[model samples]
Target: MPSESFVASRLTSGNRLFPTVVEVTDSAVIRRRRTLFSRSEESIHLQRIASVRIETGLIWSDLIIESTGGSDPITSHGHHKADAVRIRDLVTAAQTAHLPAATEAGPSRACPFCAETIKLTARVCRFCNREV
Candidate 1:
């Protein structure tokens, strides 16, 4: 997937001088904040992301991206509501794209009735179409 960048509105507080920019890519979500002297960046891998929260006000929205590792979340304010939602959607899509591989890593066992290998979580035997 192509990387997308969303910049917070300049009119909002703390963004009048330098707005925050968030970039969403296939693998990660990155937030970049710039000041006069120093620039700061934070990122969370798509697979590690636990949640994406959006607080929408009348004009702008605040976005929070949390990870499963219990670290500080990446937050960006002054974004348009639509932009915030798009960010969340992109993250969800990226995470779900990797879900099947993650799920397929679980253990498998032989189906007693059919003597065929099947996922441990499966209740039916694939080879004989019988309840395992």
Candidate 2:
């Protein structure tokens, strides 16, 4: 379903004002309205996320979403603590649900002799040259 799970902005005049919003969705985390000069949205797929970090303040919080690819983390500042927490939890759950290839469920089996990945019908471990 469509969602407006969070809106983070630069707070001014001691009040909450949302100039931009971070959208949480089933498959992606999107930050819309990045600049006035151009319409740009940053979207991070759930499968690529490495971690979601929240830094809390007295009245506001910041979120840093890191990727597994070693690129720069997406940062959203001036979010409410509850909003930040919700975003963190949502991202974490999505990341766990959408794991990468190394952790993906498959038909391959582990070789008992060398603990290497092997086909289900394999009789020998190719990497270790041992009987499976």
Top of the candidates by lDDT? 1
Model 1, C-alpha of 105: deviation from truth (Å): 14
Residues 1-132, candidate 1: write the lDDT tens digits. 999999999999999889999999999999999999999999999999999999999999999999999999999999999999999999999888888755445799998987778889898788989887
TM-score of each model, in listed order:
0.76, 0.63
RMSD values, in order shown: 6.3, 5.4
lDDT against the true structure, per candidate, is: 0.94, 0.75
- Model 2: per-residue lDDT, tens digit, 66-114? 8887777787778888988888788777666666547544578988877
Runs in model 2 deviating more than 4 A are 9-18, 99-132
